[model samples]
Target: MSFKITIQPSGHTFPAAADDSILEGALAHGLLLPYSCRNGACGVCKGRILAGNVDYGEYQDTTLTHAEKAAGMALFCCAKPLSDLVIESHEVSRAQEIPVKMLPCRVEKMQKVADDVMVLWLKLPANERLQFLAGQYIDILQKDDKPRSFSLANAPHDDGLLELHVRHIPGGTFTEQVFTRMRERDILRIKGPLGTFFLREDNDRPIIFVASGTGFAPVKAIIEHALKIGFQREMHFYWGVRKVSDLYMLDKIGEWEKLGIRFTPVVSDEAWHGRTGFVHDAVLQDFSDLSAYAVYACGAPVMVQAAHRDFSAQRGLQDDAFFSDMFTFAPKQ
Candidate 1:
């Protein structure tokens, strides 16, 4: 048995199987719902249950509180529909456009970009080329079947090889293997071309790119692709880190500066001599009027959330003009 699902605001309709979560059903049918942490950790997939009954499985209270549930909000990622339903959501438009795939990739090269960051270049099977937007990510399937997602650091034109910037997290299941046991020519399974964080090249608006830590990975791909395609829009990059050593690819930024791309390196710890403050603050200090610009942010959830709030409220940026990808650390079991 299956239930029909309708999403309002966009009026997109799809089908949900009896045993599947609404999100899983939608995704299976190539619909792209706004979601992160499909395990129900993040609240990004929360939506109103307008017209049907649902049974929610295990989920974090921080994502959907009892009060919110009583008020009709449901986390579609974990909510299994008990009957045909209507839902109100804003992010259902792009759900059908992005394609996801799983393929085998061989490690081509690995370079240490920072003290704790390594850039891995993986060559995809020549017969199975991946077609993904510049700012999207791929997930490495691990032993326990857990997946670790990483943004593609190289632009599409690079072809054949996918680049990823991975930060070594102490005791992290995936990072441990990446730093210790992973090797060249080793085969790894990856599923991708996920997320909707790509650049919308349709608009000629100026761009503000903000990144923290390895968050710079996708932003780097977007910028390189933009340059490759001869996009004339003005772009300003603000990258934040704790210390000078953390700014691993500073030299690359310098090279980009020579090409007329505005680069600002911000540091929070006082042990440095350059810009000392939050990265978003540096952007605000330089460009007070953001109403005419589009902002792309990637990094810690705290930084992305903070930038989304402040840029929209204080900097005159339209709410829709801000796009972000929040990288969260897996909770220790």
Candidate 2:
């Protein structure tokens, strides 16, 4: 059985299946409810049950008090609709709306997807969760040196483990540790859900995402989130690498391709059968007008700069329709 849920103020409504938590249903329908630690250990998802009933699944007592429960407040992350429901929650529509957190996370898993690229999965405390926009990034805090920033590769719905793609920069101490000394269960500090590079869902315009090298991280997050919300707009992804070996995650990209998204891998240094030259050039060669589309580009500063300049000045793309995150290497220590 499923129940109809209505949100106050916004007046948005969606169906919550019997097995679905209120948060799950809301997110599945593209409703951005403010929540963290989907396990109910945090009170961030607490809201008033304006009408109807919910199962109010398992939760920490301190997070949701008995009096609050008696007063019709429940954690949306843990609550299951028992009947048609009316709830009160202000949706999160901006990056500033989500809180920034500084917490300890363990390096739960790591994989070398390429000769120079290592994928790290950081696990937070069982009692905590980090809420973030899909394309935002986090700072990996360090003890002696400055923090290292990496775009989050996982979408918000898959937040059990924070994902980061690290490129081993020669002479950079922290990345060297990731390639050499960083081990499973090693603790690391992080502060974020930062940056304003998330997708804008208000308009129904098509999208073009440009990524270079490891810049594919945040683009992967945005695309996955877009797919999860059932976003129907046409999407084309262009990934640029120096060589065939530099391109990773083709399996995931293949899945996206099957879902009607267009994927183009551009090789710069050595070429076999794909488009060559700069990544942005491939985009330029395809589209002549971008006035009605939104472009999200992430990569090195030079590529981002060139794309922004060319896309707007030549292709008639509006300044506001362009969004980007430039990946700059940390200073060598």
Candidate 3:
């Protein structure tokens, strides 16, 4: 009960099961299609049904007007193929092709994984989708002052819902509210795909990812994306936390380990059963010469700075081989 869906221009094809939306099928096969909300209520997945029979699932009338339907446009998020289909849709292949958008989102769900870590699932409006690279972040537009930035913890291949990891900044307005007052469905504004932090797929060097605290957010996205695209280089992930309890998402990390990515956990505070000391120190101790390695490090400003400085100075890593993200202070070098 699977149908082949062909995307135009790019001419890429993937299988869509009888119960699968064209968008879901494409993403499951590593095809990047532009979509915001998986629900048919949004028209972001709208594309011309060039040649196919489909059961267009329920969606608001205005979302797919009769005129548009006659014109062959269907919501890929809601349409299930009745037969093999040919579709005319733009595929997202480059960051520059994605338009930065300012959209309102609702807090769909929240989980307090650690004492100070909160995981938020955001739902965009029905008609909007924010196309972003795997390791980018979003700015939550607040009432006044600057927008609070948070890394998108979810990989692009799993973009049905936007996931963010927020560390509770004590006494901080937004975080305090997020921990104490924000409820499911609470509204917020966001602008993103904002930073240049992402995978450089052009190279063939071994990859070393260093993450600390919530900085694990972006690193998680990059690693997940790499896995989805079939990682072509050796990958070593080093996650450093103050205590073992601060480490969450071990199950996902375990899956990555099974996929051949090495995992190293470093604890800086309290006694631990694993490697001890700063996360970067763990990398330094292991990789004395990293001239051919690509490093993607994210975390506290000090850790990012230290990993960049030492890995290049001592390990012989090329200046262009390091990439880091935090407020987009500087370019990758």
TM-score of each: 0.70, 0.96, 0.84
**lDDT for residue 265 in candidate 2, whole number 0-100:** 94
Name the better of 1 and 3 by TM-score.
3
- Highest lDDT against the true fold, candidate: 2
Summed backbone clashes in each candidate are 3, 0, 3
Q: Runs in model 1 with CA error above 4 Å?
A: 1-98, 331-333
Q: 2 or 3, which is superior by TM-score?
A: 2
Deviating ranges (above 4 Å) for candidate 3: 37-74, 83-86, 126-128, 201-203, 327-333
Candidate 1 lDDT (Cα, 0 to 1):
0.83
lDDT of 2 by residue, 138-177 (tens): 9988887598999999998888899999999998889999
Compared with the true structure, model 1 gives a TM-score of 0.70
Per-residue C-alpha lDDT of model 1 across residues 180-251, encoded as one tens digit per residue: 998889899998878888878778889999999899999998888777656788899999998788887777
lDDT of each: 0.83, 0.93, 0.86
RMSD of 1: 14.0
Model 2 CA deviation exceeding 4 Å by range: 331-333
Candidate 3, position 109, lDDT: 95
Lowest summed lDDT window (length 10), candidate 3: 324-333
